[model samples]
Structures are given as C-alpha cells and as structure tokens.
Target: MMFASIASVALERAQMTRALLLRMIQMAEMRDPEETGPHVNRVGSYSIEIFEKWGMKHGLSEEEIDKKRDILRMAAMLHDVGKVAVSDKILKKRGQLTEEEYETMKRHTVRGARLFLDKASDFGEMVSEMNHYHSDFDAMAAQVALNHHEKWNGRGYPGHVDIATGSPLKDYAVPDYPHKALGKKEEEIPLVGRIVALADVYDALSTKRSYKEAWDEAKVLDLIGKEAGSHFDPELVEIFFSCLPVLRSIQQRYKEPEMPSE
Candidate 1:
C-alpha cells in the first residue's frame, strides 16, 4: 500500500509540472499568435533530439542524458515564457520592427530568466530531491530562457546579465550596445543554450509565422548548413543533420494545429 501511494503521488507531481508548462504557454499565446503551444512543443522536442545526439557523441552515459533531458525539455518550453512581459505591439506586429521596437523585444530573454530564479521553492524540496541535479530546475530553465538567442559568433542578447536584476552584467557588456549584455560566443554559451538556439531557429524557419511563410525543407537545411559556426554552434549543427530523421519526426509530431476554413 505504501509503495502504491508513493507511486500515485509521483504521478500527480509529474502531471502538475506539465500543467505548469501548458499554463505558461497559454499566457504567451494569448499575447502573440505565433507563440502557440505547438511552437513551444516543437522547440522542446527539437532541443531534446539535438541534445541526445550531442550527449552520445560526447560519450555521456544514458543516465546523464535521461536526467538532463527532463530539465532540458521543460526549460526549452519555457524559453520564451518571458515574452509574457513583452509588449503586445512588438510580439503581434505583422511587419518589420523599428530599432527601438526590436530592443524592447530583446528584453524578453532576461525577463523570462528572471521568472525562474528562486522559483524552485514554489515546487517544494521534494521536486528538487527527486531530480537530484546539482542545481535546481530554476537554474537551467533560467539559462535556456536567457541564452536561446545567443549566436555561436557571440551576438546574442541578454548575455551575462545579473540573473536577479535582469540588468546587463556590464563588466562584459559590448561597447554601445543598447541592451548591454555582451555577446556569448563559442563555449561561452551554455550547452542547453546552444541546443535550444538551433532548435528555436529551426522551428521559426519551418513554421509559418506572422512575419513569413515556412521555408521548404531544402531551403531550411541549406540555411542552417550555411549558419554553422556563425549563427549556430558547428558541433551542434553537425549533430542536428546526423539525427535529421528524428528531428523531422518531432517537427511533424508537434506541427501547428491547422486553422478551419474561413
């Protein structure tokens, strides 16, 4: 009876954690049509596929992959959760944004990161103890949220910020960059960050959004290939094409729900 009871509680906790991911996605979807549940789901799915391949190539054990996958899945879904705080005009704008508007949109990274800091307490110690990661879920969720936009060439926003303040860690700030956080290049970007960076761009290109229609597979593949070492980490870019079959499966599995004929 005790074993059954413990299993039941564990299941409930798992459901609640998923519920939280849905709730946050719903909030962002309300503001930006492009930030749909399907989009986040796809990003999360792509992130894991990329991560799994990277882990294997780097010789990480199955146990390490399993544990990190759990956190990476949840964190990838919340990567854009900070968009909840961005102005609707920016997110919903149907056309190109002016420089000022673009800067405002970039703040979402730090804003999303700020949401996760110190949030583990709300989920309780049991959640942490069960996971057994060195840092709590909040830390990784915050990292992905802050680093997804970062480029392998070191031009991503919200780089090196004070996690608590969301203020640019000015010590490393680039000269005259309005948003202040310095670009995180190469290994300076976190692993999860690099994984999601590729995942996010893939989804953005593969899906139809307010800004543009989805690119065909060949075009999309070509662009990602060209971006290797510049926009994306070269190693991850290689891992991505290697697991192309699985990643393609995830894209279809989580593709956007179709609209009814008007």
Candidate 2:
C-alpha cells in the first residue's frame, strides 16, 4: 500500500513536468501567432492514430504499442519547437523568402533539436536518478525534433554526410551553420519521427495559412499517396490512409479556431 502511494505521487509529478514542457513549446510557437493554430494538439492526435495502426499491422503486440504511444504523441508536439529561434521577419513572412532567407528558416530543425538536447543534457542525470521513463521520453522528444525534417529519399535538409560516401552535402553547398546529421532514410528514420512528419504535413496541408488556402481533403490525401515512397515511408503512408476516417475525426475535433479578420 505504501509503495502504491509513492508510485502515484511520482506519476503526478511526471504529469506536471510534462505539462510544463508543453507550455514552453506553446510559448515558443506564440512568437509566430499566424502559424500557431491548433497544430500541436492536432499533430499529437494524428501521430497516435497513425502509430497505432502502423504498429498493429507491423506485428507489434498491443502492449508494446500502448507503452510508447503517449511518449510519441507528446514528442510530436515539439517537432517545431525550434522555430522559436527563427526571426520574426522570416517566420512570419507573408510571401516567399529568398534562397538565403529560406536557408536561414531551415535552421529551425537544428535549433529545435538543440533545445531538447540541452534539456536532456541538463536534466538527464536527475531524471534518471528519479525515473528512467521520464528520461526516455526526453530523449525520444529530442530525436523526433532532430529528424522530423528528414526525407525517405535522403533529400531532406540539415544534411549529414552519408557515412558510406563520406560526402555530407552532395548536391547543395553546406550551410554556414552547424547541424546534426542522422543520415536516416525510410525505416531508418525513427518511427516516432516518421509519424510526426506525416502528421505535421497533413495538418499543414489541411489548414489555412496566411500564404495559401486550406487544401481539400481529397487533394491532401492524393498528395500523400503521390509522395509515399519519397516524402514519406511507403508502409506508414499506407497505414495512414487506412486510418483516414479516424484522422478526419481528430481533425474535426481539434479543428483550428477561426482567426479574427484584420
């Protein structure tokens, strides 16, 4: 009975820590108010739905999938936390940025990763001493943030040298800034990262932004199908399609609140 009580208190404290971290992410996103919709919440829901379907089809036991689902869901929300470091002129721009500005914008992925990395470095020891589960979640969050921008065909940004070729930026010149490179592709990308990538893109396409109108559901699904093996993992994309009905329900439930017109 005493052990049970202690465990309950630990769980409550963990939940509080998670809530604090999520609020930090929200504050960072508030910097670019126009882009901050219900995106984080919607992406979290979408990722869990996709991960569940994909896990079941891939032969993962229900227990295994259930154990990691919440962590993955929470981590997905931090995928864009690095954008806080982006300049207002670039992040809030109403029009296309020049190549230079776009390059600067891409640094958000690295910056986001750095934020979690710093957290992991600072609190990792303390969390591990208290609860390994919390430490694991922090590490997973960092990984998802770092690799969410990676592509299946290896064309994604914050490029790293392919270990095989020893060439980091084969096509484009290296950026002036420092970045981490995982050199992951397809199944190589962490499942959590892959899930968040699809969720992120789906939410972005389905919602309206300052630069473009919201895309129709059919158009968005068609684009997902078209990019299955290139922009997304083919198998996960199949699972995503299978769960479209549920995905749509989540979309409706967390539908972005209408913005006031200027």
Candidate 3:
C-alpha cells in the first residue's frame, strides 16, 4: 500500500479503538437502566448544546469546531460509565441512600476511569482526567467533571470550597493562584462535562424517582436559572435555555410519541 494509505489505515484503527471503548460503556449501561437511567441520552444532547455555544462564542473554524463537537458527543456518552462498577443495591436505590451508601456510589468516577483505561489505553489520559476532574472547574475544564458540584459562593463537594483557595491540580492552580478573584470564564471548562452536569441534574430532577416526583422542563429550567450563579455558569445556563426549543424538537423526534388521548 502507498505510504499515505498506510497512515490513513492506522488513523482509522485508532478511531475504531476509541469508538469500541465508548460502545462497550453504552451497551453495559443500557442493559441496566438503574445504573445510568436515560442519562447517556440526555448527556449526549446537552453536550452538543454546550459545544455549539462554545463554537459560536470562540469563533472556531468550522472544521475545528466539528472535531470538537464529535469528541464532546462521545465524551458525554461515557461521562458516567463508572456506574457500571457500583453494586446493583446502590445503583438501584429507590429512596434516599444512607451516608455510607452515597459515599460508595460516588466512587463510580474512579471505577469508570479504570474501566476505560483497561480497554483503551491510548485515551487513558483523557478518560482519567475527565473521570477525576470533570467536576473541578476552579482551574478550568480540567476541574469541571470533578468539581461541577462546586458553588460560586462555595459549599460544594469533594473539596466543598471553590478552587479560589487553590485547585487540587498543581498545574491548574499554578496558572491562577489565590483563585478567589478568578472571574468566571465559562469558556475555560470542559464543554462535555458542563453539558453533562446540566443534563444529568435536569433528568434526575425531572424523572420520577421513588422518592420524588419528576419536574417538567420549565420547572427544571427555573431551578437551573435560580441556581445559575451558584450551581451553574450563567452564560452557559443562558445558552441552555436558548437551546430549549431545539431540545424540544430533539425530544419530539427521538422520544416515543404520546399515545392518542382516549
């Protein structure tokens, strides 16, 4: 084969490897809804919303943005792949979990990283970074997935405080020391995790759980808006709301149509 053709084959192989890793996570989660529920679908959709916003805000080249969009879509799908490791007892808890049970449930991030690392060693860095720090936005996207629960006024989890004091990642902290004054740059965080956080929380709140009634989209958006400064990035939250019309279209297209009124 020509040299260019050989290189193309190699690149395709790598892409296939990454794709297979994602598929494994999805298939496993699908078999057990209690573990991830309909979360993957919601994450996929929300991540696209965030990325599209980011692309527009940054004015990225179409080709570059498209690549980023693809990665965000795949990343969103695998965000909670760690749940597959949790025991069914915890994963399927119908009511509020005991403190210990909740703590155990939280370990899915570490578990998920291990799962991805074992299968797709090439993307180990991305998977591990996302699993451990997707919620940690104090430093940027690096911290979002790990620290998404963090509040602007403080009172989040894991660290419980903002990265203002200092991010756990020395590298991220070095760039912005004494983090308190770090004006929110909503663009710096991982678009994939930010979007997933919104989707995960919205679906979790909206879907009827054993303990609580599901809230509709408008109610969920209201809550999200109320918490924008503390719980979410205001700009991104605005983008989320702006995209609601499109989101409704997505739901209408993919979700089963309601049965005719009888």
Candidate 4:
C-alpha cells in the first residue's frame, strides 16, 4: 500500500508539472498575442522539420534523430520565454527603442534562461540547452542562441565581435572588441541553433508585429538569403529556404488569432 501510494503521488506531481509547463507556455503566448500567436509553435515545428531533413540527408540512426528532434522542439518553445521577463512597455513598445531600452530588451535572454532554470528538472536537459543556446556565449548551444545574432563578417550584437577575429567586421561608430572569447566550441555549432536562427527571424519578420508591417514570405526569405554569411550562417540559409513552401503551409494552418484590444 505504501509503495502504491508513493507511486500515485509521483504521478500526480508529474501531471501537475506538465500542466504548469503548458500554462507558462500559454502565458508567454498571451504576453503578445498579436505578435506571438501561433508564431512560436510554428517556429518549433519548423525547427523539427529542418532537423529531420538534415538527419535524413546525413542518414542518422532512428533513435539518435528522434532524441535530437525532441530537444530542438523543447528548446524552440522556450526560445522567447525570456521575453516574459521584459516589461510590457518594452515588449509592446510602439516604435524603435532608444539604445538604453534596447539593452534592457537584450537582457530578456538572460532573464528567460533563469526562469527555465527554476524549473529545470521538469524540462530535463532542455532547460539548460535553451537558456544558453539562444545567447552569444562560448557554450555549445550558443550557435543556436548567442552566435545566431552574429554576422559572418562579425557585425552582430553583444559585442559585435567578428567570428574570425572575435571583433566587429564592419565600422560604423562603436569600438570593435575583436579579442573577446570565441564560443565554447569553435568547431561545431549546434545544427539546431543554426536552424532556429533562420526560423526565428523568419517568424518575426512574417508576423504582423505591433511596430512594423509583416513582410511577405518571399520578401522575408529573400532578406534572410541575402544576409547569408552576413547575418546568418550561410549553409543554413540554403537549407532554410528550401523548406519555405512547407513553412508557409504551417503559417497558414496555425495562424494565430489577433488579441482583442482592451
């Protein structure tokens, strides 16, 4: 009887934990229904599709592919959960933010990662993966998170540090801090992050954001493709564009309803 009771308690905790995860995901969605809607869900799905395609092309084992796909999906869902920590004024701002506000906005990645850490056990390894994956860090997942913002010529954010010299590739105004540390593993960027980088940018551009008009699918793809090696990983750009037809289908199917204005 004691054994059975313990098992029952464990099951209940598991259920409650699952419920909370779903609720939090929804809360994140509600935070900006107009902008978010089914956007994240589609991004998650797109990430999975890209992984599957790559895995098939490379002939990965069934189990290995499935495991990695699951990780990508979970990581993708929590990708923007950090935005939850940002103030609505910033998140829902009408126009471009001042440099100060932009800095505050960037902190969402750190804040969002911390939120997941609080519930790490429930998400298992995914909690750690998503947090670091989206940032410009030296960690393995940084390819998907941190370095995704990095340009091939080294004109991105966090440091605008060039990927080659570890400094900015171009000159505008700020000093280029080229000697900063390269990511954790300079050898292999998480394929998932490379994939998500494209998907996330595509989703943001395609969605009708509060501040800007949604770009058509073709336009978004063209811009991303053009930025290949500049704003995004070049190899992934070809892979990403190839999947556009399917991605558009996803957008059509899961189009999020606009939130009612109060």
Give all TM-scores, in the order shown: 0.89, 0.85, 0.69, 0.71
Cα lDDT tens digits, model 1, 100-190, are 9998898888888877665455544434544334245678888899899999998777677877776667587667864477788899999
List all candidate RMSDs to the true structure: 2.7, 4.2, 7.4, 6.7
Cα displacement (angstroms), candidate 4, residue 72, comes to 1.6
> What does candidate 2's lDDT look like per residue over 1-262, in tens digits?
9999999989887877777677766776788765464788888889999888888888999898888887887788778877887899898888989999997887776676666546455444444544766767777887787778778887676655332232455544446633334356777677788888889999999998889899999999999999999989998899999988888898888877776899
What local distance difference test score does each model get?
0.83, 0.77, 0.56, 0.62
Count of clashing pairs, candidate 2: 1
lDDT of 4 by residue, 1-262 (tens): 9999977866666556546556766888778544354876888888888777778778898887876675566567656666776788888788889988997776554455445434344544433343322222223233344434434444444343333233433552253533332332212434665677677888889887767789986798789879887667776677777777887788888886866999
Off by over 4 Å in 3: 1-4, 11-15, 27-32, 35-38, 114-154, 159-191, 256-262
Q: Name the lDDT value of residue 88 in candidate 2.
A: 90
Q: How far does residue 239 in candidate 3 sit from its true spot (Å)?
A: 0.9
**What lDDT would candidate 2 get against the real structure?**
0.77
lDDT of 3 by residue, 1-262 (tens): 6999977866766566566656765665764563242455666676677668767887888787665565555555666665666777877767788999986765554444444334245444444434222222112223333444334444343332232223333333323444322222344434454566676676667665556776887788789999786666676778878887776665554442233798
RMSD of 3: 7.4
